[model samples]
Target chain A: MRITIDEDKCCGAGQCVLAAPEVFDQRDEDGVVVLLDAEPPAEQHAAVTEAAQICPAAAIALA
Target chain B: MTEAPAAPAPALTTRRAPGCPFDPPPVTQELREQAPVTRVSLWNGSTAWLVTRHEEQVALLRDPRISADSRHSGYPTVSASFEATRAHNRTFITMDEPEHNAQRRRFTGDFTIKRMQALRPRIERIITDLLDAMEQAGPPADLVTDFALPLPSLVICELLGVPYEDHDFFQRCSAVMIDTRSAPEAALAASQELLDYLEKLVEFKAEQPGDDLLSRLAEQYLLTGESTVDECAKQARLLLIAGHETTANMIALGTCALLQHPDQLAAVRDGSPQRVAGAVEELLRYLTITHMGRRRVAVADIEVGGQLIRAGEAVICANDLANRDPEVFADPDRLDVDRAARAHLAFGSGPHQCLGQNLARIELQLAYPALLRRFPGLRLDRPLEELPFRTDMAVYGLHELPLSW
Candidate 1:
């Protein structure tokens, strides 16, 4: 699965990091969500889904 | 244009400290009953319209016209204030919508009732583990240092993927920010130091992402092939600062409120989970840890509590007063565990309700009962009057609650 972050909508709460650190990260300055891996290796796909699911902003999308 | 309607209050004459910052002026209860909303002077000698009435407070806190950003409304800061209070509050809590909504959106999931419920098991484990540790340590222990303080701080740190050991650094930074005597320079300096460290962590997370929020944020947004390093650090600073301090204050103050009322404490200890839940609700109501009001700047002419608030006037919605409003609550002063206290402004009401209310609630529900049951004999080591209290801090609390079980 591919992970995506809608920067405009992300609040940088850092919840994504807690759910799946391998995939999602919060920028320290702008406080917005950023995707670490556009497409996770097959083994890490579950982490991507977790990040996508736990996102408070609904800014993360996993395809 | 039509002329503005003036405030209902006549110009007031006297300005005084009603009591310790933690203790509200007994007259505040009357303010809600009689005047509701009246223009009054703050302890720092600044002008602010205090909203004491129930409906008035609800209307004002939810109103979009009231901006939280102090820079916009000309916040009435004191002659020489510390920088920490400003740094600590400058994030979502102090911003209006758009910026506030945008920033709050990022961290929103961590606070949902469902999300917090999911966290219940972990919270319970933390409480039980801490109780074990406290029991192992024996009597005359510092509850503030051992259980009350550590549990929430540790939980928030884990939530943010921050190393628990690094807690000392952020704890120091939070202290500086909350200090009544801290100079603006001192607060700013501490803030900068923490930001700088977080900046580096963001970079490391970007190049080699880990299974953490900082790592994810770094890889996705910070490393976005464009944003500056300093910018990411500022955001991290906001997260750590807001996450831990408020929860810490709540844990300390909430425990004290329960200890002071042992009959209610016994009810919490012996009752079912439902009773514990009710007790938790009551504690939030009685304690009202965030005793201060949310400051707002009026955008245009508006009438609140039968008073016409002119544009640009400052408004302070007293949450403490709202929690104790007689009309909404039957016998508001008495701590009834089953009083349907959910409507309280403790987490606040309306659009700006505390974003962390869910997490805060779970922490209390899990921790308080385990604490009382583990040490049924727990009592204050010193007289309540002798305990160290922080009256001047933004979030007032006991510096150290000495407990002997």
Candidate 2:
């Protein structure tokens, strides 16, 4: 699974981090999306997908 | 394209069915089924489109053409007081991007999921201390006063560097601020009083900085000319009111709901952290405290659910109705803690979603289990129907929850 985030669109509600903490994190300075792993392992696919689907801002896109 | 004049629309109301305090007003449910995107009259006799279905409501919330700014003409406000106070109380939530995004980002770092999670120990300590005090005072305590209200109030005060001792004063002002029934003058006065209080605090923080949000705002935004003292205080005022009021309602109302559902109560009390987290989501969905639909104005024409909403028309996204939509959750009205209910619109959806949601979640996850575990015999002291629910306020909750152990 591949992940990309739009920092411009990110409102930092942090649902992505809550859903897939290992794959995502927020910048401490502004809480914008910080991509921890662009290409996550297969085991983390479901959570990463859920994170994308539930992100309020639609900031996280998964491919 | 001439059309016949339409009949006057029914007025939107805050009335929940008698004895079913948890449910949205029956009219809203009817509208959801019959006309998901239909016009409704506001309190001012102005008409606004009411979007009730989950699917369409989410779409409208995400639509950039819709404006959250209350200052816009024909904006559907909750009450005259809300209309009267809008000019005095505008915050980031009321502004549109890219300004909204810029203003909101300044404080998002402090409320990120990770930062809130890191405060778990401190929050747990607050819960424990409050519970200890409640126990020492014995049974038949007003949980709202003794536990639910203070837990969030204390945490927010410490975080914002506001003195907890002033809770009584601030809480009183906030009460007036949210009460939809308050006269316009009273509402304006209350908000001005809060803004004045916080402005003084911002000035003090500038002089003697502390390791808190207010101090950070003073040093970073206030001094840098990025924001004025009034602007800083307005933001702080928003945090102060929102940080406590919404969460306090959830804590009290959620506890009341659990006491009535013994089996669900047991699950929350004996469940693991994951289980408790799930329960919190379900409870938030089941008892969405923000019963007033999210109000907005359509700046551009948009079609939703087969209806064309024209520009300059006001819209009310009835989130409570959306949260209870049967299409989203089977047996939509049931309080099933085990359900995968994380997609709920309790905090709303889109760019204007609640910022303190992560912090609220941490506080609730710790508060519920701690309270239940500490007092195994905890139960409501009075019947649910007899409790004074905050129906008059913009946010739905209990005025007081009488509890005994």
Candidate 3:
């Protein structure tokens, strides 16, 4: 799956990072999500999906 | 062109219905139905937009134009005391954008799900130990003082490197700060007391750092020159107060609510991990203990729910009412432990949603079942009406919960 984040909508609640740290990292400056990998192997797909589901701002989108 | 008739606005009242202690104020329900985005007169004689609909609240919280900065003119204050203390060193909660995000990020690591999960064993130990003491003390215990309050207070104290023994002092100050009826001078005094205590604690941590949140903050913010010692202390003070009070109340009030619904309480007491987690979320929704509405100001003109809120207009997002918005949760008033209730605004919404939610969740997840499992016959010692509830405080919760097995 390919993952992307809307920087403006990221609320820095940190749920994304906790759920899928391999795929998502927050910018040090403002804590906005920083995409670490656009596409990950099937092994990490569940984590990515969970991250998106847990995001309060709905800033994460996966295809 | 003739102007249409404007819906009459109901005056905001904090008093919950006479005996339905678990429900939101009666007038709040009326306003949610009649005028979800109507103007209500506050205690200070200032009127602000009181948004009650679940959809409207979520939209407003996410809108970039809305500001949570309490310093802005026309920003709705909970009371005159809140306005007086607004000028005190602002916590990240009251900050807007860039600054808010920057400050909030500094401590997010400590509250991340991984971190909170790691702390679960420690939190469980705390809960177990408290229960042991309560059991030792025998039946007819005031659960509020004995179990509910101390569990969170001790955990927070450990996290921040603050001595739990000093809880009485800090708790007193926190009570003064959040009490809307408190005098302005008293509020300021409380703020000063907590700030001063935190300042000293932060300074001490700088010299003798430990593996705790305050130590990390001192190293990162104070020692690195990213922030002043006082600024770091102010942030610590805010966390210290919020870390304990909100959860403490939730524990106490939640127990009271669960006892009222024995069937639901049974599920929470004897359920799987998934069931317990869902129960926690549902309880958070049903008893949105933070009854005082979130206050904000519009930095730009925004039209929502067929009403145009001009720039500088104040808005109060009443989460209690929003949580009960029938459109959001079917039979929103019912406390169904198994329902998918994670979307409730108990922790709020948007960028400024609660920082310690994951930790709070774990605490509740562990707390509810443990308490019930230990004392299966737990029941209120006094009638519901006789128990003291914190109606006047900023956070809605029971002041003292008397219980016996």
Candidate 4:
């Protein structure tokens, strides 16, 4: 599965980071979220889906 | 240079404590009978105007003349540090439009009525799970500790993608963030601790990525560098703190209000889900749990309702008063459980209205029925007078609602 992010729609609400921290980390200073990988591995399916569900901004897309 | 017979310092026209300090003042009736805009004293020892009439409140709340940011309003605060003040100010609740709109737009997906309703099953399971635990623990249970408080905390934790078990730590840390007497330094330290904790959690989510709000925030906004990491952590903190604390109080107090009125409770319990939804609206209006008014600083001298508000003056738009305005509601205190609750300002009006209103409504709708049905014989363990009403906290609610079935 591949995860695509819309940077403009993301306001660093951090639901994604909380859902799948392994694939996402927001910065320490200003809190802009950082995606470690554009497409996470298969092992991250559950957490990735969880992220998609919880993103209040609908900034995450999975295929 | 002392003058004899000095004029009175500014004071709010407060009626005798309407049950408790946490409770709303008797402005609705006065506004309905007398002037819509009347002068009142603030708890901070300053004078301000209370907009009570339904129409006036709605217009004033929506007007551009009022500002939602407390800092600009000379709004009296108890936080220790300016930064701590800023931390609590992370969410758009304190913002005006454009900025507020931009911020809210990001989180709008999870807050739609449809979205909140879709989460009904999960909400039900959560409530049942908590009630089951409460039942296992037996009677004389502290509803606040066992169910009321933990339910929203857990739900918000899940929604935010933070670990629910961390409720205790965050709850404690969140305290100084909202304590009425917390100095700026103390509040900032507490806020920083939470931010630090959340930052680490974000790292974990980044590496793993989950379906939680935090993971997506990291993946989308933070990862792209549109906003800073601290900004992202602050956003997470805002959700966890405001979303959890406010809803926790609503459940506890709303439950207590229902238990106080058996007829109303029975109506909601026996009626269809639609009826319960109506009952929830009425309860939100009647209770208006977030009694603290939204503070606004008058940027330019302007006359509102009938009062002339001066530039730089701080005013609190009391939602509780707006909820009970006789002009809008008939027998506002009767708890009919079917009043035109849509007219109430509990979720507020204008651009700063609660983004979580949809979620809160679903929580209440799902909670009231599940609660009454699961514990049909549920009753308050102590009299209302003896119950610890939270006056010191930012959000007013019962501290520990002891109940037995």
Evaluating just chain A, the predictions reach TM-scores of 0.83, 0.95, 0.95, 0.82
Per-candidate local distance difference test: 0.68, 0.90, 0.87, 0.72
Best candidate, TM-score-wise?
A: 2
Where does candidate 2 stray beyond 4 Å?
B1-5
Worst 10 residues of 1 chain B by lDDT: B12-21
Comparing 1 with 2 on DockQ, the higher-scoring candidate is 2
Better of 1 and 3 by DockQ: 3
lDDT of 2 by residue, B1-405 (tens): 222129888889878888899998887788788777888888899998999988888888888999999999979988999989998888999999899999999989999887888888999889989998999989989988998899999999988999999999999999999999999999999999988999999999999999999999999998898899999999999999999999999999999999889999999999999999999999999998999988899999888887888899999998899889999989999999999898889999889999999999999999998999999999888877899998879889999998888
Output the lDDT of residue B235, model 3: 93
TM-score of each: 0.79, 0.98, 0.92, 0.80
TM-score of chain A of 3: 0.95
lDDT of 4 by residue, B1-405 (tens): 121114543344333264543346554345446566655565556656656666666666666777766556365332234325753555676676558767766676666544566788898899999989888888989888887778888888888899988888999888777766677678777888999999888877777889988898888887888767777888888888877888888888888888878999999888898788788879888888766655566776667776777777766677787787766788776788876575567777655667677678788888878888888999988877788876656777877899989
Ranking by TM-score: 2, 3, 4, 1
Highest lDDT scorer: 2
Could you give the CAPRI-style class of model 3?
acceptable
- Which 10 consecutive residues of model 4 chain B have the lowest summed lDDT? B1-10
Q: Tens-digit lDDT track for model 3 on B1-405?
A: 112237554577789887899899998888788766888888877778889898888889877899999889898888878889998958889998878877887877677666677889999999999999999999999988998889999999999899999999999999999998999999999999889889888989999999888998899889999899889989998889889999999999999999999999999998999889889889999999888887899999888877888899999999999889888789988989998776688888877899888788899999999999999999999999888999989888988999999
Model 3, position B77, has a per-residue lDDT of 86
DockQ score, prediction 1: 0.07
Candidate 1 off by > 4 Å:
A1-63, B1-23, B76-89, B225-231
What does DockQ give for each predicted structure?
A: 0.07, 0.81, 0.36, 0.03
